[model samples]
Target: MARKKRIKIYSSNGKKALLLSPEEITIVKNDPSYEKNYEIEFNKGKQAFEVRNYYAIGFWKDLLFVLIGAFLSTIAIDYFISITGNAGLFPGGLGAIARFLSIIGANNITISASTLYFIVYFIMNIPLVIFGFIKIGWKFSTLTLIYSIISIFFDLILQNIPYINPNEFSLLIDYNLISSLPGAWGAIIWIFAFAIFGGMINGFSYSITYKGNASTGGSDWVTYYYSKKLNKDIGSLNIKINIFILFIVICLNTIILKTQHIDQTIKLSAIYNEYNSWNELINSDLGKALDPILSAEDKVSIDLFNSWKNLQTGNWNNEDWFNISKYISSSSEYDSYYTSTLVWKMKFKWIIGPSLFASLTLIITQGLTVNRLYPKNKILNLFISTNKINEVQQYLFSVGYTNNIFIWRTVASKKNAWNDQEQDLIMISMPLLYFNKIEDYLIKIDEDMIINIIGSKAVKGKNFSYTFDNELREKALTEEFMNNGKLMKKIESNTIIKTHKKMKKNGVSIQNEV
Candidate 1:
């Protein structure tokens, strides 16, 4: 009789092999005849054998997810990253360099902000793809390559929008919500809002692609690769990158202040919304130039002058200039510049303030998100002090924690060590897969057993050593014991372990791997 039940299985070791571009999956039920004989056969031809019990890597679901994630990444890159990096320039980095190159490309060759970003970013991902292939696996690297190509295709389509400018699309939606507030608050909110949105979408984009067995490329590749070599959280590595970008932002702004700061006055100026300015700029001779804080029907508010905007064209100056700029206090020299006509206006300094807040917001949000979704693939350390040590120890070993166990006789501390009876202290470190099953069994054996479980951030044993740092970038692909660690094998007793869900995020103590 054919059985309808399906059991999940996979060849973890074979997955890393070169022949499997994507692993193959098949369903096989329990059988007895095939087990007694060796399955492989060779006779000067391709070998054939009954794979009575076999499994392959599950890549179909992740492949579909990667396709969908590629589209989402397109949205994140085109809408938020392009808008914030090209238009605002607060959290400047390689994108700013692209925007600057686009500005000079205005002579005879005009490249849109989106196009330039694609060119710059894609060139950087080639090596990362190779690294992924070598370190991660052929399957993961192939999926990432597919995801990157699909996202690039989507971007190519979006870049064809009439304006070919990312901010031009954002300009279609006016952002007067908080920027309309009085004093420096408007400027502060303006940059903060963009940074928050940009950082969040970017985070979600990377995480989603990660779940799809891919990445948003660039820093995602570098962060994960180094996260292993350095033994650190991927989010923390990203924080370092953002902080470095902040330094770049400051340096670039300093360059602007020193080289291009204007001390002159032109005709009268009216304060137009930043959106209106981008709208007018995208259609002008300098239409493709993403640096457009001064390209509107009239002048933008003093507070909206981000560091990248050249002040000379319509820099507000002259004695009649409003004195409202003094209301804002700025420690950076880039904040305010005196005009030849004796006019003083706040530079708006959207650079430093917004970059700082965006960095902080990203650090917190990304950290929390990773912790919730991808707690490290860890080995849990069980510390047990019990009067019924023999029963607990036997049950623990029977439940599959047979390796790396230590026992010591100990006495009660608070009850007066000399007078109290001694009990054995049992310690074992094993994968989280067997944790709940063993814990439940221990509880049944001795309700009074005192147990403490501490998750290890890394693990190195006789045969294996790996750190499945559950960051936005990795999967628990190397959880070795999940397959051969006794619970998976049929035992005389019918005690079965269920599939484990994600680990708890909020409350858990994690110790260093030993």
Candidate 2:
């Protein structure tokens, strides 16, 4: 018998591998099969060593895309708030930032809620972009900063534009026209038209910014960093972060209400309304029947009823009611008769609207990215029978698992036969989104095929991550061009030239392939 001899080989990392015999080493040096294995190993190493360029495209085009996305997001925010009455519908962290700013200057300056919201939003983004710089990259951080600044100006411009002012636009619609509709129709319209549409618009803006390797700042930065770090779904992480922020905002709002004496004003308004109701009751037939039995000179009831009736009829609308001497001397009466009568009603729709909007927006956007957000690649491994392997592999490739496949033949002991059976075990790494389709395909090929699904927190090789389908993008562009042919025609030349130059210069690779 010939003695077995081993030839040691060293990996690029300097780790020695006892892999081949003397004859195997000779084959490895000259055989095509060995060359193919070497190429695969070399490519795997290259993937680890190659520096990933975050800004794969030029800064100018990316800046334009980020700006457009930011502008659309601002529009969505304004429209959502205007239509929903601010009941807490501002998306993401803007509401909490706005409320915090308001609390900072509750006494000194009187700023419009809309103006304050945008101001706080822009200011808070300054620190947030720093995190983007550290976690993401320079290009991403710079684009986010630009987006924040441009969006602030864009929001201000839209607020001044009377024709597109969300408040004015919503008011122009006649709710009375839809009054004959079902009671729930109003709610349905508000949710579907304002909430759902606004959420989708915001999601589109986010997706666009993400495609350009940028973010819109605020909770976006938080979500991005933590999602990468924790290897969790971006949407799930966003919900947790926003919920915590929302809780803080609610606490701060309660404190503001207490400190500003707004709660007292609300109580006073309720009391004033009650006084008017009593006055009307006294004037009714029931009161007339009871008046005879009541004690004479009931000053408390008389004063309240008389004061309320006088205010209702405008008998106390004179300057004498504003006189300092009367105010000081009859302060208690003055407060009940005039102070409480003054309207100091607070609209909570602003608070509630933004909260709802932020929550819903996170849910929609996260749902869209969940399947692709994992850091590690999920794979479906199969110990498929050799006879059905080709059919199974082709079916999977057609569905979207185009690469990352391996196969090997092995002998298996037969239960009651003299000969052993040959079986082929196939392995494939695929995106979780295609799991169901692959499973269904496999069932058609062999119902008893051995299968195992394994999830990883990190994947190192070529990744075919889920991305937006080109068919959808093409359809959207076609519809837009058809709807506004003249507008598209005017910009078509410039758009094509710019796009071609950018793609060429940056060596931009398209992710989605037919």
Candidate 3:
């Protein structure tokens, strides 16, 4: 056999090299002279590929975007907590991690729970940033760190806003609406509004951060890392992670309740042991009836009988009665307080808060992740007749729908020979946001035009605005604009009023037009 030929391949670190036999190498290296040249070219190509695929939208710009995202996310979290009165209702990925840390920190620290909670939240994210640095790119990790820090700073600032105390900031609208509404109607409205708006805001913030190719650190880093490693979609990964966190939260709350119950039981037992029996128990009608039946020869029964007799005969000291009354009153007060506290805590913390948070988070992450993976703008396919195609196409292009409009030649069949005309078939794929406008424009051109609108999941092409942009993304999904007909009516009314005033000033009779 010929001398076994060997080729060198660089590892990802570019420091270590691997030797492969010619037979083992997938590509054939035919020219001996160009073997070294081939390796050099391959290395250069690898470097170029790496550089091209990396995501970075300038250092400062990315930082700014991440900061803004963090700020908005913080506001959303605060709003959620205010409305629900349950910090556990925070829907962001970092929320579960933060709440876990807060609970642990609150147990150990003497400081304000809220203050310690944020501090721990900030500290816990450091490891996540490090992990991102190693697994993801350094730029992404740096941006995440910046976002976390900025978020922590903002959280602190929000807590101390001169006239506005975040802790005291309640959702007055929600409260008022809930209070005013009868039965479950108020609660239903409050919950629907809270979950929907909160999810939207949180999703919007996450999308904004993602657009900068970074995360606010926490599950975001984990989701991105696994998404890349496993060759999976980030949105799917996020849903799985959040579901796991929600489960953990439920388990934790259960453990907490059990532990609290055990502790309360132990305290009650200690109180029972300390007081033994109160005068009320000894002086009861049953105690009096039972004392006479016991034999005096029995020391145990005699001691109990004497104790009961002493208590009923007013032979007990003032100090003993004082201690007995104090203990009984304190125990009653404790039981009453604990019952109320437990009810509120369980209602808000264990049930309503987490359920709302999880539902909102799931909705947001699922929707947003799908949008991110499919960045193309949603389109509506419009098929129109040729007679009005020119007018419609011109109007669409004029209004910035020039990206994708497919035209075709076809015969337009008329029902009667009297109205026969050559009709041009035009198919236009317009962005969903402009669908209403396009429909109105088409109707204006030809009121009886044969128009069909088909909704498309996405439209892929250059020069088209992707749903990644926050404002456009929100407007498209929320349908924030008024209906075209209503808008046109308003405009027409205003124009008529202005025209009528102008005509009156000019001394012209335009009353009929007005």
Candidate 4:
């Protein structure tokens, strides 16, 4: 009998080799020549390894795009909302599409609206993924899924965590949402910013994935598919398509708000967090008592408009009616009722400012299209700054962040700690900052206290854990609060912002407001 055929394969790290029977090697081969096929497979493995290395290099580049995209999208959407208000919607026909979909069991179906929505969305999204997969591979699809899931998860987490509010977080410092608005040019500026930033991220990610012979397998797949099929350049067209998607998303947003009649309610929720529960009965006498007396105000506005129109005609009025009209107009202006409405309006405006700004930022950047932009504000910037080795410790202390710091000092530590261990979610105030840093450190310290005398990373050995956030700071500020520092001021006067940055330190950034 012939000896059982055997083959050997080498790894790039020469210390070990994989033993495969000739049959086994053949199982993976497209051709029958064992040596020739083996060589081809070996070369492919080496290529994959090279691709992964390139991915490592491009990770930072992709990250930069995420930041840029998030910032621009936030600004763009904010401006869009400001200009259009909640009345923004798709022009005539698309409204009918959404309305038709909703009317035809999309929204009205017995299945929960959420489940129906996901089903519809998934069905719509499948084509993009499938098209993406053909050009790139399963790996590209996987990466896109990973990023998409992670992004969605983060959005969910942020939404649930009251402390991680994106709006107040966006305007933690002295920044004004109104200032970002560009009047008639706002949408144009916002769109460009979002697209450029998002495009950069998408390009960087594509480069890395492409180098690995993988794809992001979303819109990027569409980019690749068209590029290959039409024998056209992929880069520019991809960006344009993504930008178009972003615009579509913005238009869709307007349509959803208008059609669903949810815009005003959403605005109220964003501004006040007042209607925290749907169970709050409006029919209650207390609720009725709390209801704003705006109906009377509406009547007055209609009367005033009519009176103004009448006055415009230069018709003489009786003397008694003129005096009564004058007093009524004065009461509308200076009365307590008018003052109450004005105060409420002002407060509502303040609350919505940050949200509208952030939304505009997202929209303008065309984030849905490019995926380059990453929301920028105080908290994120703080996280980035604090990720440095020296800063990490102080950051922990300042934010009052606590977790097992010494658990992963080495490969040994990681194995031991990870064995039958709880999930290691080091809940720093902001993830965009802390995830990248502290890869290696020494020593273990108690999680309870900041300024832990013992906890130090043996790799980059240091003495103490960083300062923690103060109780007051924790109470008053949200997670996005960390990003509120004046970026310019921090660069220039560093000291001033740091004081407010860490609640442990005694400083007040908002002097006048407080």
For 1-514, candidate 2 gives per-residue lDDT tens digits of 9767754443333432334465644533453343454444444433322223223425666777788888877777666543443223434465455645644553457744555566777787778877777766566688888887887788788778977676466532432233223332454354445555566667677666765557777787877666555544466556676666765665455444421222222333333333234355356443343344332336335544444345445465333222222222222322323332232222242233333444455445533543344222354444455557777765555444545578888776768989997777887665454464346657778765777666645545434443223244334434534465543332332232233334435664321111
- The 10 consecutive residues of candidate 2 with the worst lDDT sum are 320-329
lDDT (0-100) at residue 106 of candidate 3?
63
Q: Which stretches of candidate 4 lie over 4 Å from their true place?
A: 1-126, 167-218, 228-514
- How high is the CA lDDT of each candidate model? 0.47, 0.51, 0.53, 0.35
**Candidate 4 per-residue lDDT over residues 1-514, each given as its tens digit:** 8777554443334333344465643343322333353444444544454457446755555544443433332232222222222322111112212222433453445532222222343344567676665654454465554443333333333334564344334322212232233232343344334334433343444333333333333455566556545433456555555445544544444434322222222323332322222133134332243233322446445554454344334443443224323433222232232233333443344333332343334333333332332211112212121112444554454444543343212111245564642222222333222323322221223232122122222212232222222342243333333343532222222222222233223342222111
Order of the predicted models by lDDT, top scorer first: 3, 2, 1, 4
User: Per-residue lDDT of 1-514 in model 1, one digit per residue for the tens?
Assistant: 9534433332222221111111111100112221221121111011111111111334666677787777765665566544543224332344344434443443336655655556655666788888888876565677778876777677878877677546456632333333333343454455556556655555565566676656666566666677566554466557677567655654454334321121111101211111133344345332343234333424555543432243324443432122222211221232233332222221233233444455456445644554554344457888988888777755654433436568998976664556676778888776553364245657878777788888787765444323333332111221222343442332101111101100113222121111
Q: Report RMSD for candidate 3.
A: 23.1
List candidate 2 segments past 4 Å from native.
Answer: 1-61, 82-88, 99-112, 171-193, 254-514
lDDT of 3 by residue, 220-284 (tens): 77776765554334666676676667656645644444212222223333333333343644464
Q: What TM-score does prediction 2 earn? A: 0.44
True-vs-predicted CA distance for residue 281, candidate 1, Å: 31
Residue 241, model 3, lDDT? 73
Question: Which candidate leads in TM-score?
Answer: 1
Error of 4 at 391 (Å): 42
Clashes of each: 1, 14, 1, 57
